[model samples]
Target: MKKIIEGKIWTAVCVALTLLMIVSAIWIGMRYYVSMDIYQTPSMFLEGEYSVDGGEWKSIEKDRYITDHFHKIVFKGKMSKKLLMYFGSLTISSKNVWYTLKTSDGTVIQSYNFDDEKLSYEHTQTDKPLALDMPNTPGYCVKTIYPDYLTKTENITEDSDLIFEVEYPYSYALVSYNDCVDVTAYYNEGMYLRFFYDALPPVLLFVLICFFGLFFFPVASFILGKIDYKYLTFGMLSFLWGLYMIMQQISGYLNLWIVDPTVCMMMDKITGYCFVAAVLFYFKANMSSRGTRIAANIASAAYLSCVFTVFILHLCHIRDLNASSMTMNFATAGSIVIMIVLLCVEMRINRNALFFLLSWVPLLLTVAIDAVDQFIHLPGSHYFNYGLAITMIVQIVRLIGDLRLQYKEAIRHQQMQKELYEAKVSVMTSQIRPHFMYNALTSIAMMCEIDPKIAKEATITFAKYLRGNMDSLKQTGPVPFTQELEHLKKYLYIEKLRFDDLLNIEYDIQATDFVLPLLSVQPLVENAVKHGVGMKEDGGTVRISTRETETAYEVVIEDDGVGFDINEQKDDGRSHVGMENTKKRLHDMCGGEVKIESVVGKGTTVIVILPKEGQPNEDTLS
Candidate 1:
């Protein structure tokens, strides 16, 4: 049992280490993706020439103006320049907007924007237009500009004269003039990538810790079952909950690299629902009854409904790539309500479920903060993700501590059982000595009077058998079959002197390479001679034989005497003391089975089947 427990611990540790390596690999892969050099630059230029107050057309000239604080051009006046170049912010009240920009040589540039403000216009002279149209020209041309990657200047020499126009104001004025342009790209800063990379080590450590926590739970369950300790089920449940949470954290980190926000949101919700279901299932299996089962089924149905609803919304385009806050809020509210209902059911069933249920406290806070953070565009929500990792680790530790206590209790119980068995064996062995000594002494005295020479031989055999019995009492394992047979021979020889001509014995032993419990065969032979042969008026034969069965070593002792009914005789406790002792010794030593078959006035056969040495029985023996 101790070896089994140790093996379990070893396996758990190895699995924990393996999971840690896998998590580390994933973390490294995520870090590598984040660190790759990538950038998205959105550039804009004038699409049409227009002034804020409908001013006259002015010549558009390339001018480089440097500010005192920063070396950058503020503005170059042009009546043909697009309205987007006149202001820093553009707010369109119209349902749609369209504009055109004309260049000096009558080239035109076209641009458009939806309600997405992040893709708003930005002004920069370095970002040249491909084509533009002069306010009154009918031809278009590309603007010349010095390329960043090339040393030469590219000019708008081809197709310089073209006319361009666009209809706008579907709902209201869709186009507006903007002067200042924000020239920023929507890409993560290098420092933010570094932060993500640095998070790998801690995340990997936490995953390893959770795996270790889960690994011990099954072993703890087995030990607890052995000792009948039911409360350890809580420890198992806690570890399972910890594992679910760790899985969620790992999945969340993975989702960051996935560009589809809808899929990411769905994954998050599914993970949360899965965690709740796992906890509820554990509670229902360990603590609650039919009512909890019904409640769990209802919660499960609700979660599935919510998942289906989210999918339908996405499919119908009601929830697009950028879903509105109201849609997300509704989903979150529905999920929380379902989870809260499940929590209430759990509380009604088991108050101790609170420990596991309370783990969601921080998770609930995270969800609320996540909602506000996404709306207000704030940071620190990632810290809540980290907080979840910490809570999972704490729960894992608590589970481990609980399992350790159960293991200790199991070990204690095993020790008590072993002690009780030893005590019973000792008492039974003590009962055999006095009666056996008296019978042997009486036989030797009678032999001495009748035959002096045979008496001396009988006394020597008696001495040897006694010595074997003494050694058997001290040892706790099977004796060699050869040694047991030799003891039986000595006992039969001593008994022969008592029976004289009335007793006839025969040995039909088969070749064997096995062992049995000490004195196992001798006691049965002694019982046959005393009870079976002694009751017959005519001389009877006692036969001892050893043979091999398909599965085990078989020893048979039979006597032809006034055979009693085996069933009626076995229940006579006082008469069957030797039979009981033989049974107990076989059980403790070789884990063999003893069977006695008899018929009144026919004969009695006692067969002992012992497993081959060094091999276990087909079934659990003890």
Candidate 2:
């Protein structure tokens, strides 16, 4: 019945976590998709360039044009035209002298030198005339020449199309131009792609899940410390993957170094290696022999060396940016080899390796997709990264479940141990009870036959001792110092009837602010009577006292009688169950210390020092 309830609770927890992961993934996907859609589309622009004659149209290459002294010029012509005059105008400043035609309208067009600062016209008689540009010269000169030609390209008729050659003197002579529509369009596309590829919605949700999941670690640790197979398995993998993502994000943000790309790629591969290492560690800690654990550690160290080597190569530029892709390849091969070794070991031991083996699938897929993307620049490559993250989360959840189960088993075991210990103490206490009762009854029977009044008194004392025992057993709260003393007095009175004039009892309790363990005082008093006074031939005195110490409340029971040898075993064949039971009860109840000072001729003194309220002094009891 208990198992069923526990199973139901665990099942519910798993279901809830699964639902949360799904909802978070969806939320992240949608937000990323929406943001991506909004930023991907680019705006279009329509601009025209004209030559003196009808020629092929040229569109400006905005990026190059803005930074160089070249402006695009274009026109078209037919084969019938013999010569065409191409007229264009531009301003020449003292800082800017020459102009160059950066791009021609047709692929076959070539350039020839023209006067440095002059605006010129090209004469072409051919049918097809190409477009050309004078670099770094302003359009203000053309406006001045034909003010009304704002929206038109003026064509000077000739036999053929015309072309002009241009050159520039300085590199920085090109003027910068901004087109709002074009810039806006570029930004939209770039931002949309970034948002889409990152999958912001799912990532945000996952972050929250990770944050909340951390709280369960302590609870899981306590309950499943022994059965750490699943906890270590999932915990190690999740930690590796999380670290990998963090490294990727860091590289993405700090991409100024030459080795950044390599580092980023290595980080991804290391994540997989780390996952494998985590699995190996989990198995080692769980079921692997010492030799297997050592081997796993050695293998993990070797893989780490390989990772460091890749990093060094990248930093030193021994391998180009393209060569960074090989890191993943090496890692993948290494992982496969390690996996085989682990599987073989597992097979030999007849242990289940399914979980560890299955964990590698998503990681392998992630590695493959990433490698392909880096080498060939394929589409949908980033989705593999997302897949890896999701896989890691699933693995974490599974690990958490395993941890929970282990925790439950541990708790159950502890409870069972506690019950067994309690039962043992109870049986030991029962042994002491019968012997003490038999002595008290025999004493009372003798008193009844000799003296009626003394017999009545002895009988009452016996009844009071039994009553105190029953009350102490039933009461859960700590007994006050004064009340516990009263119970001790009753028990000692019964013992007095058995020993008659041979026994004398003394008690001096000073500290009464707090309570002590229930029935604790009586047991120690009974021990003093049985062990200290019982061995005396003529007579004995039992002294009981309490005092407040600097750190604890001290209770002392000392008796000077026919002191038995402390080193030798007791002559009475019976067990020392009473003393043992008293020690156990004090340890459990108040966690107080029990000190025994005994000698062959001196006698015995049992000193019990209990801690005051608010202090859990387990050391004293231990």
**Predictions: Cα RMSD each:** 18.0, 19.0
**For each candidate, what is the lDDT?**
0.52, 0.51
Q: In candidate 2, what are the lDDT values of residues 465-495, reduced to their tens digit?
A: 6666555545654566778787778777877
TM-scores of the models, in the given order? 0.38, 0.41
lDDT for model 1, on a 0 to 1 scale? Answer: 0.52
Model 1 regions more than 4 Å off: 3-7, 10-216, 219-289, 308-351, 357-360, 365-379, 423-622
lDDT of 1 by residue, 1-622 (tens): 8778867767776877787788778777776675344322122222223222234443322231111111111222222222222222222111112333334554433233232231221323333232221121111111111122111122322223323223232221112211112121123342223335554455456555544444456555664565322334444444545545544434333322433323444444445545544544443443355665676556556655665665566556554312332444465466556556665767776776677667657756776675555345453335455556556555566566766776787777677556435643553464346776687789888878889898898888788866765665465556567777887787777667667888999989894567666666776776788778888898689999889877788999999877887556255445555557568667656678898888888878999988765444435342
Worst 10 residues of 1 by lDDT: 64-73
* 194: Cα error in model 2, Å: 4.5
